[model samples]
Target: MNRLLCGLAANPALPPELVDRLIALAATPPGPSDLPDPAGLSADYLADLLVRNLSERADLGPAQVAALAALDEDTPAQLAHSGHLGAGDVDPAVWPLAALALLDEGRGLPEWARRFAADPDPSLRQRLASCAGLPADVEDTLAADADPEVTAELAWSTTSAPVAARLARHPHAEVRQSVAGNEAVPPASLAALLTGHGLPPARSCLVCDGREIPFAHDPSFQDVDRDLPAGAGCDGTHGSTVHGTWARALSNPAAPPEAVAGFAGHPSVWLRLAVAEHPGLPAEVYARLAGDPAPRVRAAVARNPGTGPEVSRVLAADPEVDVRRAVAHHPRVPFDVLGQLTPTTRLGPHPLPPISAATPEELARGAASGNGRVRMLVAHRHDLPPELRDRLAADPDASVAKAVAPHPGLSPERLRAMVALHGQQVLARVAANPDAPGDLLAELARHEPSARRALREIASHPNATAEALLPCLADGKSRVRAAAHPALPAAVVVGLLADPDPEVVEAAAGNPSLPPAVMAQLLP
Candidate 1:
């Protein structure tokens, strides 16, 4: 009974009388004699579950909010936290707990919270500091507070440049460290810390100059070979505060050229690697780092957007595969260099930007390369000339032929020809193409001992006709996909709800053709 009520409560189209009845039932717990409680859940517990689920409904209005609020103290808090009740709808003065919960959840605060900046409770001031768009006077009061934690919280959260600058100079190390991490901290202040000028000597790590700990202990750098120049460590043991401050300052976009230049030559390879990736790096500094003994540093330089053509060409032929791969995608890499590197470069999930901008002649040259991998790269390009595409489609290599089969621009005649030549080899790719013709998809659907994987793609193809999908419903391999096809008759979709296979039933339930009335009935 509770399950049925929970389902009905979630239905947006549920009648108003049903909603009122559910709320009334929640107010009065069911007696032992009222119904069989097969689940053995207590009446009070079931009532609370129903009320909470009802509170989640977006359509709840003032009347529903009031009724739920009256059922229990927590319901009002839940209603306010759910965001269904506006400030005018629920009076915070009447339900103070609801108002406090709103503040704790980081939901919009009440206007009265403005006074919290000077509230005697430091925690309250700290919470108020985290809120956006605080009044200027309120902000000033919090920034001047005696509590370092309040100032630290403001330092980490503040967008105002002046507040960050002031906090950067705070005598307390914690507050200054927080300011160092804040994006709005002035570049000069970050530079000062990076250069160890304004930073206190007590905060400096004696063991490794704030460089060894991250490389030795940080998981992000675990793959880095410890034998590298950066890891010739005296000891990995050190306080994190000092090292963290320098790292955060170095990563800041506002980091000054002086700080960046200082870090480039730092003894720690980790520091040099960080500076190499900085987008605002000066050209001369970038060029200098390109020759860094560390391959990872060279790789970072290759990946840097500011790396110029000369540096790109240099990295293109570097001994390290990682460095070559990184420069292969660089937009500034010389065209001839990119052509030389394509055969060995593996395609990652991200498209190669440089190749996308390649000239037709360059693309043709790549298509005609002796290596199949080079031809495979050419086949992936969306702008490949038709003459070149057809020539590659007939390539002796099956993998190269498959690579070009899915190009949406492939003409229908070419798609058919590929299927006739390769048969099932290219059938799945043709079916997956968005531009695959309906007649071809229908023919593929009826092919003998059909490509099991291709049938699934054909079942969901937008161009699939009713005839194509109808046959799929009988094949267990494609039944679930067929059940979900929008082209399936509404009657057939509804009938699939009773399928023995749970997957098919779920697919049927999700089909848009299933009537809303049937959907409500099918719930639970």
Candidate 2:
């Protein structure tokens, strides 16, 4: 190689294609020359550039992806030379690449997955648990790997059936906890896991307890407030050892009530909150939590199904509406408590419309409510009868009208007439109903101009996700065009950055939907 070309290979900007061209052009190698100081290069920027550039290569293959994944521990210098090329830099470029790497890297992958799976190394195992594309068949290896971490990772995949069963019995309490807490594991499965427990929750530890130690977490589940960016924070600390404990509490719901009560005074509210809200907490525990000073703790009590009607009745009378909202939704709050929920009313700054329209009792009670939500509730309840629906149909807030639009007890004909009889606001609720009948939209067009506009907008939208209103991008409607323009496809949206309208262009450029390339073009 020409000595100069060899020196130029160190230029970060010189793409691989450029290097090859220079190498082919050079005829001779020179005396020993030092390679460029890779340390001088910005690791992050170089990593991003190389990854982006190589990821797009269509000819990229799996051997390449595996190579990059392996180079994870190598320095930047080793990486550039080992052109034994793993999927170039694209191995981590996209979720798909990671998935591809998992599949392409054969079973011979360093026994890390097995070792890490069983590893006492919390950091290694937690990272692996969150890793994409773990092999489906890895369960057997993991189950036998003997590290609580490895077995926990397998249990966390939760979807792995074979792993789930063994992990349910594995000697470690934390491993079993991961199984119990896994969303994929059904409540029934959790019931089964609870079958053999002796004490201390599911606390088995290969590293610690052989016989005397009980399987367990701190009685109160605590969230480690590692203000550090995710994946950069600490996990729970047990004994003298320190490792990542982020994914450790996988199946804690099956933990016993007494175990949870043990942590009610935990220094961290996160842990207290966890204990307060844990499904395993029996009614007495949640009721005991009813007077917790933090609103979240009290809210947890209000929400727990275990709280009996007597306790729920007392909590419903608490001043906080948040507590009240919880009461409204609570399964145990009997009708008597629900009746007490009718917040008192008397006209003030926000005068509610007259009760003249509602049937006598609801109108009287609703007219008295100081809270609009309470009044709105009275206006909506089925027990109010038909005459009341007509009276409050004129309530000033658009939200109030929409809230009343879909009473199952109200006849479809009545709902259709309300669309025409009422103004624009009812359209939002009608639109929210995926199964809304055509007659309602037709009536809306006849009665409300704003409603007609919404209908036309919905019909013309580019991307029609169930929640998507018409995207206005290149479309002519200024407000809608602004909303829709940003959500355009990357190739198309990037092209839209040069659009003449500032609103259209700005929306496309600034919109969350426009990807990086489009944003870059728009910004610069």
List the candidate 1 regions with Cα displacement exceeding 4 Å: 1-157, 170-182, 199-238, 265-270, 291-295, 357-432, 436-510, 515-524
* Residues 111-146, model 1: lDDT tens digits: 645656656878667866776666567677778888
Query: After TM-score superposition, what is the CA distance of residue 213 in candidate 1 from its true location, in Å?
Result: 18
Q: After the best TM-score superposition of candidate 2, give how far the Cα of residue 133 lies from its true spot, in angstroms.
A: 12
Name the candidate that leads on TM-score.
Answer: 1
Candidate number achieving the greatest lDDT relative to the actual structure: 1
TM-score of 2: 0.46
The lDDT values for all models are 0.72, 0.47
Give me candidate 1's TM-score against the actual structure: 0.63
lDDT of 2 by residue, 1-524 (tens): 22122223333333344433433332122223523323343334334334333333333345443433343343222332333334344322232223223433431243434544554645555556544456665456555555576567657665665556666666665576556656555444444554433323334343343423332334354424322222221122232111111122312564545645666665656666766667666666777778778878777777666667877787887777777657656654564455576553221222122222345764556634555555565555534556666555555555455666654455556566556555576764554334445444334434435544455444333333323333323235534343333333456545555555433443443344655443332211
> Among all windows of ten consecutive residues in candidate 2, which has the lowest summed lDDT?
239-248
